[model samples]
Structures are given as structure tokens and as C-alpha cells.
Target: MANVDQDSNLDGATEGSSNANAPLKRNSDDPGWNCGTLCDPLNKDAIKCKLCGFICKAGITRLKYHVSGLKGNGVAICKNASKEDKAVCVALLENPKEDKIAKRKREEEMRAEVEIEVEDNEFYAGSKKKRRSNLRPLDKFTNPINPEGPFLNMRQQNLLDALSKERTHSVHQFCARWMYESGVPFHSIDNDAFEKFVEAVGQYGRGYCPPSQYLLREPLLKEEVERTKGLLKKQEEESACNGCSVMIDGWTDRKRRSIMNFCVNSKEGTTFHSSIECSTDSHTGQFIFDYVDKCIEDVGAQNVIQVVTDNAANNLAAAKLLIEKRPNMFWTSCAAYTIDLMLEAIGKEGKFKEWIAKAKNLTIFIYAHHWTLALMRKFTKCKDIVRPGVTRFATTFLTLQSLMEKQEKLKTYVY
Candidate 1:
């Protein structure tokens, strides 16, 4: 390639003073052109070698073999050709096939790039002149060269439709895989915000980059907080108009810290008011009363129709205090909590307790041995004899019920 460039410069420099007989026009695309020139203006078969001034009667292909020191061609090797010139000729002769393949690949890549650019422009601009100018050779079949010609044939239209469907399926698979791998809930797909997000991305087209972690955590988080505040404000207004109940629930978190949740329920919906960690404070009647009173004040005393709490001794004491303080508003025990307490008391009875203990021992034995557990599952058709529930007492009852339902299967397994 360097030799070719040097030869080109030499030709340009000597063009003015050169003999009129020297070939004026050069085939720049051919590497053999750098090694020699055509002997006659009209005869391409005869090449005059620059190195040895040997006029080969054969074509440039034979001249290249001669200059490169390759024998057996109809021409003699150029004795005056230097080693560097021989190497250049050898490389050019040997690599034409590989060079042609590489050139074709580059051309295909360039065509693909042009097609994508044209598609993007067509999608956005939709101008006839622009589309005509940018249309690929293959596209000319579907897209009319003249405005009077018919649009895409049925075959081409179907092909385009299939491609669009494939594109949509690919996008869907990408989104589904991300959600599945990331452990995002399936029901989140039904969320209005998620649907809108997909639509927004489609509208924005190809270059839509998702929000970074910092944006999601900082600015987006702050925006969502403000939006939630607005919704809560509306809920508060409804609560005031319709009258709401203040419901208190106490539970321990995974860290074993005692936490109390305060919620306000109205016809509109239930809104979580606040939560407080009471691990450091004693859960006395006074503490409960103070917290409930503060919640009532926050919700507005007139809007609070009732204060509902679990039927625990401290909660009962707090109810009495609330009744005395707010005589107009009612104080009540949670009915669900009362039922749970009844279930707990019934489970502790002698007969029920003994049955529960035996059931627990059977479950423990089966679960302890993998073989026993697998046998039980096979007999039960993969249904376990233990059924958990939301509450401890409810879970016990549910498990007992499951045992009764699976009694035949359990007997078969045991035998």
C-alpha cells in the first residue's frame, strides 16, 4: 500500500515532463498498476514493468506473478525487482481473495447502518423525498420508485408485519426476564404506572435509557413522597367529613422490637397514620392512653368516631381512660382480636391440647425424616397435613382441620 502511494506521487510529479507515450490514465483500484503501466494506450494485455522495463505480453495477473518471484508463468521473473517490491507484489497477489471478502463485509455493514438511519428518519419524518433518497436497493421493491406505482405487495406487507410482531415479542421477553430475575412481583405488571412506563418508552423510541439508581433513590423518591403527601391530604379531608376510626395494633418485628401501628379507617379507605417502636418503653395503660390520645388529636377529635384496640388488659385500661376523656366518642375492642383470644382459650383445653400435641409430634416426626415426609406427600397427593394461618391460634385450628381432611392419606402413609 505504501509503495502504491509512493508510485502515485511519482507519477504526479513526473507527469508534466514525462514522454507523451507514457500511459496517461491509471487504474487506481488495481495494485498491479503501481508495479507497471500498459505498453499501448489501447492494449491492456501488454504491461511494461517499471523495475526492469521488461514488457510482458501477458496481462497484469501474469506480470504480478513475474515481479513477485513466482515461477512457471509464461513470463520471466524481474531480476532487477528489489526484495521489498517482490514482497509488496506477493502480498497483493496472495491477499486479493481475503481483501475482496473483507471489502464485501464492510460494504454490507455500511448498508445495514444506512438502512437503520433511513428507517429512523422515515419513522420520524415520513417525507416522500427523504424516503426516496434513503431507500435501500431491496426497499425499492416494496417502496415505489415512482409515486404512481402501487405500495408494498401483500408478501412484503406480511413480512414487515411479522418483523414488527417479532420485535414486540423480543421487548416483552426482555422486560419479563428482568422482572423475574429481579424478583419483582407478577401483579406489579398490572399496575397503571408500569403500563404507562412501557407506553412512555415506546413513545420516546430507541434511545430511552432507564433511570439510574441515584435518580430512582433521590429525585424520583422525593417526587413520589410529595405525590403521596398530596393523596394523603385528600384522604384526611374525606376522613374528617365521613368520620373515621382509629385502629391500633401492636406486634414485634423480625428484629424482635415491639412496634405499634396506628391507622385511620373511613368509608374512603384505611390509611396508615404512623408507627412507633415501643421496645424501650413499658407497654403500660398510661403509655397506650397517651399514644391513642395523640393519634386522636392528629386525626382531629371531632372526626374520630371510635378508638379500637386489642382486648389485652393494658388496652382495656386505655379504653376506659379514652371513654372518660372523650365521652362522646366510643372506645371498642377489635372483634377479630376477641375471636382470636376465644380460639386460643379453646385450644388450651385438655382434650384439644392433647390432640394438638399429638398432631404436632406426628408432623415433627414426618418432617424430621425426609423419607417419611416424601411418603406422606405421595400418599396425600402433595398436600401437607399442616396449614398455616395469619394468627397463631388460627394456624393451630387450620392445621387440625388439614389433619382431619388428610386422615385417610395419613393412615395409608403410616401403614
Candidate 2:
């Protein structure tokens, strides 16, 4: 219930002097987090977990993981951390429904205060009250400004039906609650104490409070549907100016799934359209063509002037097929990918290949050894070696370019 300074390195935890070696005090809400037996001999700038006896660098995040029973980054989770603390920590790691309901309740209270207030009439004028006739039609009260604003959309209706709620669900309130509960100010979610704060009010609040995930599922779905509808509507409006071109990009996810994403580019601006999990079938020329055809049809065949994809055999086949079918709308490979391929090919030639290998080795050497990596950062003004891009060839080209730029500074450090 108490506020703590957010500026200190330890967020809600108690801040000590600026001495880098000093361990931050366990945050007020964090129960039973301390170093204990079997702690290895180490300098002051290291953390020793009391429950699991794991030692690591002195950082608040590591301490939090230990106290919250989160095992990550080579640190073992504390076995002795309270199950209550662990439960709250896990709930906030994902979206929780009770938090959303609480947030909506808070917004409603605030909005009630801000809106036009009506007070009871103090006195009536000294005049005889006229008898009222029931001749006025209540239908005349219908709003002329936004006649359809009061009704829910088909998506919202479907959402309510899925949830099996007795009546129609609210629209505006659902969206506000979704964002608030989802933690729109993203950095706050990283706080170890955020879950504690939410649970405190949720458990102690007056009246019946719904603390179930089922309550949130409907609202989250409705919000997502509305969000997609708004984006597509915006795209439709923008594309009216000059239509749009589609670009298809493919990548293999960690699970070995082939994913294809299609984006629209126009004078108005580039916008993402959709993605498809294409791992199911053989993505031959025919497979890629079928997906591209669907996108063209969705965006309007005549409106799409061009389709861009990589220069793979299957993609080339797809382009040929598209050209044969719709001659007016062109399909071609991406120019940037072509140039990146060239840079990669050039780097692989005879002596240049050796130079690229040495550059990679130097990067690996510094990164593998923490002390050297630190020294390298200090020398190069805190910039890491230019990271490799998604493609292997392109990655080599970029890292080589980066090393060349820092050649003089690296040489001085080496000597």
C-alpha cells in the first residue's frame, strides 16, 4: 500500500547509497527474500539466493526472479519463495481478468465524477400544476446525430453469444478495460511489485468482486475484433487514392513452421495486411501462387498494381503464373533482397571470404569473453558489433561493414 521511488535502480525496492556493490533491500511487498547458507565466496557486487543457494551478479531483476519463483537467465528459482507470491507473479506475467474488471470499475468511478452532475430541485414556483396528457410519443426521442451508435456490431454479438451471457455486452467499456488491464503503459508490467498492488485491492475491495479469467476472455476477443476492423477500414480509405501493391515475405519460425506475411505498400503509407502459416503443404510455385491470388482478390484484383516476393524458384514460378493470368498487374522479386544477395556473394569471393571469417572470429572472441566485450564497448563508445541480419549472407555483409567502420578503434585496443 506504500509508494516507493521508481527512479532508483531497484524500482520499488529500497535504495541504498550509490555504491555499485551494495545489495538492494528486498522490496517491501516481497516476503522472505534473502541470501543464506552455501553462498560462494564472492565480491559485494553479486547476489546469493537464500533458498536455492544460486549466486549471480547483483541486480534487482535477478533478486526478483529468485523471490518470485521465476527461473531464468542461469539463476535457479528460490524453493522457499511463498506460493502466494509466486501465484500473483505468474498471474500478472500474462493478462488476468480480475485486473481488467477492477480497472473498468475505477474508470467508471472517475467518469462519474467528471460527467455533468444533476442536483435535486430545491423549490417549485408558486403556480398551479397543469394536468399532463400522455399524447407525446417516446419514439421522437431517437438521436439524429448518430442514430446507429447505440447498437452493438455483429462481432460483438457473436462474442456475447460465445460467452453465453444472458444479455448484450458493452462496447466502449470493454475496450477501455481491455487496455487498462492489459497494461498499456508497457514498462509497468516489468515491475516486480505490480502484481502485488493489483492483488491487494482485488482481495480487500468491498462488495462482490469477480476474479475469474472467463470474465476477461469475451472482452479480449471483442476488443481484438474491433481493433482489426478499425485497421482494415483505415486501409480501405487510404487505398482509395492509388490502390496498393502486395509484398510477400517468408521466414521459418523456431518451431520449423514456414510463415508467410503479406504487406501493402502505397503512396499513403505501407501497412501490414495478414500472415499465413504455410507449413502444412508443399510450398511449391503453385502453393505460393494460390495464396498470392487470394490476397489480390481480397484487396481487389484491378487495384493491386504489383506483387513483390523473393527470387526463390517457387516464387519465380508463382510470378510467372501470375503474369500469365493477369498481365496488367506485375509480380516481381524484391530489389532489396536481390542487392543483399549480391553483397553476400561478393563477400564470399577468394580473399574477401578469409577477411570476413577473421571479422567474425574477432566478434566471437570479444563476445565470448565478458571482460574483452566490456573493454570493446568502452573503446567503441558502447556500441555492440553490428548484429547480423535475418539472412546468413546479409549478416556477413553487415558485420563486415560495421567492423570496417570501427577498424581504427579496434586496432588501438588490440595493440
**What's the TM-score of every candidate structure?**
0.58, 0.48
What TM-score would you give candidate 1 relative to the actual structure? 0.58
Clashes of each: 0, 0
lDDT of 2 by residue, 126-208 (tens): 32443232222331122121213532211222121223233223433454466698777756654445444333322222121
In lDDT terms, which candidate is top? 1
- Specify the poorest-scoring 10-residue window by lDDT in model 1: 152-161
Residues 48-100 of candidate 1: C-alpha lDDT, one tens digit per residue: 88888988877888888889998876679999889998998888887987898
The whole-model C-alpha lDDT of candidate 1 against the native structure comes to 0.76
The superposed Cα distance between candidate 1 and the true structure at residue 224, in angstroms, equals 1.2
- Quick one: RMSD of model 2? 21.3
After the best TM-score superposition of candidate 1, give how far the Cα of residue 84 lies from its true spot, in angstroms.
99
Error of 2 at 36 (Å): 53
Tell me the whole-model lDDT of each prediction, alpha carbons only.
Answer: 0.76, 0.64
Model 1's number of clashes is 0
